[model samples]
Target: MSRLAQFAVFGHPIAHSLSPQIHQAFAQQFGIALQYRTIDAAPDAFADAVRRFFAQEDGRGANVTLPHKHAAFALADERSQAATRAGTANVLTRLADGRLAAHNTDGAAMVRDLTDRHDLDLRGHDALLLGAGGAARAVAWSLFEAGVSTLTIVNRSPEAADALADAIGEPARVHTRYWDDLGHIGSFDLVVNATSAGTLGQSLTLPFSLIGSRAACYDLGYGPSAFGFLAWARAAGARYAHDGLGMLVEQAADAFQLWHGRRPDTGPVYQSLSTRSS
Candidate 1:
């Protein structure tokens, strides 16, 4: 048999990643043989690890997560519009000429998961975004693309949220508030948690008043990391609440399509993982 295509995901504290399982399932759907690994690399080692993976390990493509998304964006020789818009990249492809191309699927994934998977209508909805890191930037862009009327962003470090709003350059539609000011922000039709607080096992202790009676809440963390916000959302009476497992699978499908020129059906894969996660 010909050598299997090589791919991997790079992140810090990567032991909990499900990218390998997700991608392998996708590959099996198309009868494609490939190997996907998870590489744990701190911020300092991210670039070097990516370079070595592509150059020496015959890596055809890779996924980036957490603290490494920005580094992946910077390391790429070229970027897709999605990456440029988010100012970070979650997918990296190796070109025939040995150049690295970066892309961000987080935004598209979030949009698909919310609108398609969960039947959440984003158009004209007032949305509240928590956090301003890599995931938040991408999710913010997606929410706009999905037609959220206004977006309020809040973070522990207000400067980061402000910077993201500035980057979006939509002063009229995008706004920022301090994390402590969340209680005064009024209710929202949609609330998204892109913060690492949950991933780091910290509670945000957000106000229940932030959730409208018919609101939907989403956390951009999966498994145990997603339980905190999801629990809070349920207790706050959100009409719908979900973790990022669906988004993760959706984004991985996007990356898979980019790398393999085909899209695998996400339903079975999501159901399998959801079962395991639950």
Candidate 2:
């Protein structure tokens, strides 16, 4: 028995996450045995619980997800430029002196999954983003930075969408459209579903026609949750349609890199999960 590095994903309703399996695969690539688990902590107790987790001798990092990403950013002693730009943090690392450092890997996860995995060139592509929650806000800026020609954000709450667009800066490039106007917004090279509509098993009636002939559709949810959106994409004849599983593996690899200076090969891990879901 040797020393083990401990890490976990912190969020509410985390039972279904594939993070532990993904991180385990990453650690095995470097011959490093690690402990990773899911931590279900509400916003009220997130900061305190995280403090305790890192207090462990082997505590190395924690991947923040869902409703906790913004809270994780708030609790960190220092934040990386990525986290600051995204207005959220999904990865928390224990600094050498035992302080929490925050980084948002979600946006980079999306970029990597789209570009590296699918070879979709995000640069100069028009994108339509669904939802304006924490996850949406975190990735909105990243897409713009990735060189999206224009980003049209649509959400139930028009005000929330407007605020997020404003925060993403360059008002001219980032604009908000009402949910009802989704269909009328015309086509997009990239249609990204950032809404929780998929997770709740709610039937989504998206305007998949918005997917251009050569467009790609991406759901932020993995597995079954992502099926609704991806199915719509496939039916709409999208060039490529995918779930968030790749994003999960890539982001976990990013966190692993932050914790151990090792970036794992994500192809096999992603294929493993994809096969399981299929």
Candidate 3:
């Protein structure tokens, strides 16, 4: 048998990631044999770990998550426009010449999941993005591209939110507010939770006033980490409440296509995982 292609996801606290299963499902669709592993590396060890992994001849590509996304972008020899725009990369592909290329699939995938899967129209919607970390940075531009009229960013650290807004370079359409000001900022048509509170087993304690009568609330975290925000949104009477599972699957599909030159159907995989998560 020919050697199976090697791929992996790099992140801290990686045991909870569904990347391996998601990618394996994609590979099965094409009768492609591949192995996807999870490498838990702290910030200090990330670059070295990636170097070691790609040193292997079969190391075809890698999916970067959480804290490692920006690191992966820096480590890459080249970057896609999406990566450059986001200032981070979630997917890394190994080129024929042995150099790694970085791509950011997070924003595009989230947009697809919202517009295609959930039928949420982002055009002209006033969106509120909570958190200004890597996750927020990755998807902010895409929200604008999807035609949101305005984006209000809030983070625990006001400076961080300001930095993200400045990076977006849209002083008119993009604005920042202190985390404590969420309650006073008024309601939004679309609310997104991009905070790590969920992953860290904490709650945002968001005010009910943030949800408009017809607002759609989405959390960038999935599984157990998403429960708190989803529950809050539901209690606040959000018109639509969704976890990031769909986005996760969509992003993985993009990464799969990037690595394999074929796009796998994500419906079955997403439904299967949804059942498991439920």
For every candidate in turn, the CA RMSD to the true structure comes to 1.1, 1.7, 1.2
- lDDT agreement of model 2 with the native: 0.87
Candidate 2 lDDT, 1-278, residue by residue in tens: 77677889998889988899888888888888788999899889988889888895457899988788888899899999888876788999998998889998888899899999988889999999999987787789889989999999999989989889887778888998999987788999999999999887798897666989899889988888898888899999899998888888888888888888877899999998888888
- Writing each residue's lDDT as its tens digit, candidate 1 over 1-278 gives 77789999999989889999999999999999999999999888888999999999999999999888988999999999889978899999999999999999998998999889998889999999998988899999889878999999998999999999998889899999888888787999999999899888887798999999899999988888889898999999999999999999999999999999999999999999999867
lDDT per residue as tens, model 3, 256-277: 9998999999999999999987
TM of each candidate vs. truth: 0.97, 0.94, 0.97
What is the C-alpha local distance difference test score of candidate 1?
0.92
Q: Which residue segments of model 2 deviate by more than 4 Å?
A: 1-3, 56-58
Each candidate structure's count of clashing pairs? 0, 0, 0
Q: Is candidate 2 or candidate 3 better by lDDT?
A: 3
